[model samples]
Target: MAKIAINGLGRIGRSILRLLTTTEAGEGFEIVALNDIARPELCAYLLKHDSVFGLFPKAVSHDDSGLTIDGTRYPLTDNPDLSQIDLSGVDLVLECTGKSNSREFATRGLRAGASRVLISGPCPTADQTVVLGANDEMLGDQQVISCASCTTNALAPLARAIDTAFGLVSAHMTTIHCYTGSQPTVDAPRGDLVRSRAAALSMVPTTTSAGRLTDLVLPDLAGRIFATSVRVPTASVSAIDMSFQAQSAVSEKQINKMLAALPAPIFGTTTEPLVSSDLRGRPESIVMALPETHVTKSATMARVFGWYDNEWGFSNRMIDLARRMTSM
Candidate 1:
């Protein structure tokens, strides 16, 4: 079986672990180790809600260091540094730490014998940035991979489709993203200057790096996009609202046809109204094309909606990408 290690057990990290234990997609891989600085309660919560494995069985072994699931006992290491982990047998390392991206972290995993490291957030190194479907070919053996944020995952394909079909002129997007575990329910001292405000009560305007990363993934559209984000009061399943000005005039039917042409596993289009709750627990990050609103005016602006269970959806893709890398 493929062995995997996850670092940082926060919202995304915990969701990844749960996905590995509960989902059928994770059958070929085993989570050999998990790391987090949170209290033990956090880890216990993760072990309790697995959809497939459920709570850890009584026969499972536990010690002051770590617990064993399915006869694999991963001793918890006190160190949080990615360089310190013993990854000799690990096929892939899922770096879910929300900490700013570091080339050192990816390099450390490679040096420690991990075939590849998949980063949860954007990587500081320009070379490591790649989106799953848009530039999946960029991933190869002996390479570090970074999955761009959820907004990028949702919008890139839409942008790519439009750019390919009608030619993209410029695009602007506003992502109505759900509040994450990283945000405080109550007003507290802001850890990051931008997120210090109350997240539960109000919609906060924030900068999005998706546009920048989009250019990186599809270089042909470089410097042609702008994006912003609003953090709303919801647990999971964020939505993306994208408006694109196509270079060549295209009708609503044409845009819908182009979007619908994408593979179902990559893109989804529907006549039924799509909502965030409808996308909850959805395994793939689905792009729900809004066909009715595609206007065919001078600057053909179309509103496209997409859904992503940011934590689980992105992590699922990360694991699939890892598995493909290891040929497992």
Candidate 2:
């Protein structure tokens, strides 16, 4: 069994803990410790009652000593500076603290004796950025590996499929993402002008690094893709709108067939006109919305839609990547 530690108890972090304790994916891995900024009580409360995912089994609880779930207790180190934490016996540290997507932060885990550090989002300084089906083959013995952002996870596979069938000329993606911890429920002052507005009552547009990160993982698609983001009022799940020009003729039937044939854990396709709420807890990277997929008369250009439970899917991928790294 591999020993693991998680930093941060936010949406992604809690989701990771939730899966590790309640699902089969949690097997064969032991959570040695956890580091976060919240008080032990607050973290436990959030874990037990997640507004988006609903209450976890009553078994989830915590105290000043640490968090307890699924018959295991993990020591909690409530600090933002990871360098001060004691990570003895930890084989991997799943760094979900969005703030630690850097080389310096990754090194902290390694220096503290972790065999590897798996970050939740992409980091240019990390040794490798594994996007599962897209470039998991490139995973190496790097001390630091990134499980690229939720958007990148959802986009890379589609980009690969489109590029394989019809050469990608250029692409633009707009992610209709849900409000996150970074955004406030009511209008509040923030350094970033757009994010300062109320997240629950507005459709706020913001920038996304997913396109740039996607290019890093799939070098062939570099400079050919761009992305924008819009933060919606919803609390969970997200929709991605993609428009692209391909070198070959396109047809709905062909595109549908292509997405339909994608392997498990990567994508799933459906013709139903489903709402974002319908995918609240799915673990697939993306679920192609066949009914919304459109193609130009000439088939050289097309539009595609995909929906995902960003928090749950991304957290699941983090565990999968961590396990793969330990196996390697």
Candidate 3:
């Protein structure tokens, strides 16, 4: 079995762990190590409190050194330093830390003998930004990969579907994302240069790396996409409101049919109203299209809505991508 390492046991990391535990033995890869800068107790608390998958596998056990799951015991590394871990047997590493998106971390994992690194969040220099249903074929085994943001994964396939059916001229999106670990429950001093003055009390207008990374994943739509984000008070899940200018006339029915025709394993479509809460544990759906609301007032303009379990959905993709990379 191939060995895997996860960095940053936060929202996405914990969710990924849950996915690995629930998947069938062969489909689920082995977790060799989990690292976080915070105390080990935090990771323990998360594993114990997981609502969707419940507790981790009984075969799994952890101590101060590390935890063992499915006959694989991953020792806990003292620090988040990538170079410190014994990567001699690690086949892949998943970096979920929302820290600066740098290739250096992934590079370190590779140098430590890891076959490949899959970054959960946006990286400053990602060789490829993959949206599972949209452009997973773009992933190559020779380089490190970034899964982009959860919102991007939700929006990319929708955008690509429209662009493929009827050429996309320009697109804009406003992602109503849930509050993350990076945000404080109460107002506190911000750290990064751009987010320093922002507050959690109100929706803050912030740029999203999604649109920029989306272009990389689907280069055909490059320069035609832009996005902004507003952090809401929710704990998990997020919504995306997207508008596109099509090159030709297209009705809601036409777009709905296209989305409905998508394979079940990758895309999900529903006639009933879809809410963020409804998508909580839906692992296979990278994007859910709201058929009722999709519309086009003119030959060039169309609108769509999508909901995503940002952590679970994106983490599942990261795991799948990691497995594919290992197979090569």
Candidate 4:
């Protein structure tokens, strides 16, 4: 089995470990080490009990030495600098620290002896930004790979499907995302003006990179996509409302058919109507909102809806990509 290490223990990082220790999806890999600014005990405590995912089903305990789960006690290093951490025997490092999305910081993992470094969010310096169903096939020999943001993953399959059936002309996305850790619980002074307001009490509109990242992932659609986000009070799941102009005529039936036909583990389809809450723990990258999909007059305008458990779904893909990187 390939040995892996994880850096950062935030929402995504914690979710990654929760899955690795509690599910079979973690097979073929072993978590040898973890690095974060938090204390080991805090990391261990948070891992066992999460507000969104609830308590992990497995036993987790920690001390100053390290974290123990599933009969293994992996070493924990409390440092931000990658150079100080011991990564001996680690084949891959999941860089969950959002700060390492740049090429220079991402390359530090490689210099530290990791065969591959998988970043959790968008990485401009990455050798490739991979969205599972859209372009993971391009992961070739890349030492640094980005699993793009949750919004990017949720939008990629739709872009690919639309481009495949009806040539896409221009696209826009309005994501109704849940509040994140960065937002203040109550009104507080901050660099970003809108984000300083209470997180749970307001629907704060903000900028997003999904549209631009989509262009990067699908060069054919470059300069044709735009996106924005609104952070709501909800705790977990996020919804994507996409409207795009297409070159050819299309129908709701065609969109449904395309979504239903998407490969497993990447896209999931359901005829039963679903709310954002229903997708809280879903593992797929994107789940089609079958009943809400629609097309405009002349079939030139199309609207699609997708729901994703931003934390878990993206973590699932991260786990899958980490395993793939190990093989290379």
- Each model's TM-score? 0.88, 0.97, 0.89, 0.97
Pick out the ten consecutive residues of candidate 1 with the lowest summed lDDT.
Answer: 51-60
Please give the lDDT score at residue 266 for candidate 4: 81
Better of 1 and 2 by TM-score: 2
RMSD of 2: 1.3
Cα deviation of 169, candidate 2, in Å: 1.1
* Model 1: per-residue Cα lDDT over 1-328, one tens digit each: 8888887776667667666665677788877777776555546556655542245433344466785656556555546676777788888878778774667765676677777777887886725666666777776654677788777877776678778788888888888888766677777776666576667787777777788888888898888888889888776778777778876667777777777788745566667776777777666656574544567466466666667767667777777676776783
Comparing 2 with 3 on TM-score, the higher-scoring candidate is 2
Off by over 4 Å in 1: 39-41, 47-62, 68-75, 191-194, 289-292
lDDT (Cα, tens digit) per residue for candidate 4, span 1-328: 9999988899999999888888898888888888889998889888888888898887888878689896789888887788677676779999998887567898877777788899999888998999887887788888888888998998987788888878888888899999998899999987889989999999999988898888888887888888999999999999889999988888899878878888878888777877888899999988888998888876889898888899999999999888788887
Off by over 4 Å in 2: none
- The C-alpha lDDT values of all candidates are 0.71, 0.88, 0.74, 0.87
What is the per-residue lDDT of model 3 for residues 1-328, given as tens digits with 9 covering 90 to 100? 7788888887787778767765652364768778887766566666767655456654555677776566666666658677766678788888777663666766777776677788887876767777787897887765678878888888788788888888889988989887776666565677654344334466666678788878877888898988999877566677788888888888887887787787755577667766667777676545556564555566578887777777877777777777777888
For model 2 the local lDDT of residue 241 reads: 97
TM-score of decoy 2: 0.97
Cα lDDT over the full model 4: 0.87
Task: Please write out the lDDT profile of model 2 over residues 1-328, one tens digit for every residue.
Answer: 9999998888899999999888898998988889888999999888998899998974867888698886678899787777787786788999888876567877788877778899998777888888987998899898888898999999988898899988999999999999888888888998889999999999999988789889999998899999999999999999889999999888988888888999878788778878999999999999899989899888799999999889998888898898898888
Q: After superposition, how far is residue 288 of candidate 1 from its true place, in Å?
A: 1.0
- Per-residue lDDT, model 1, residue 218, is 86
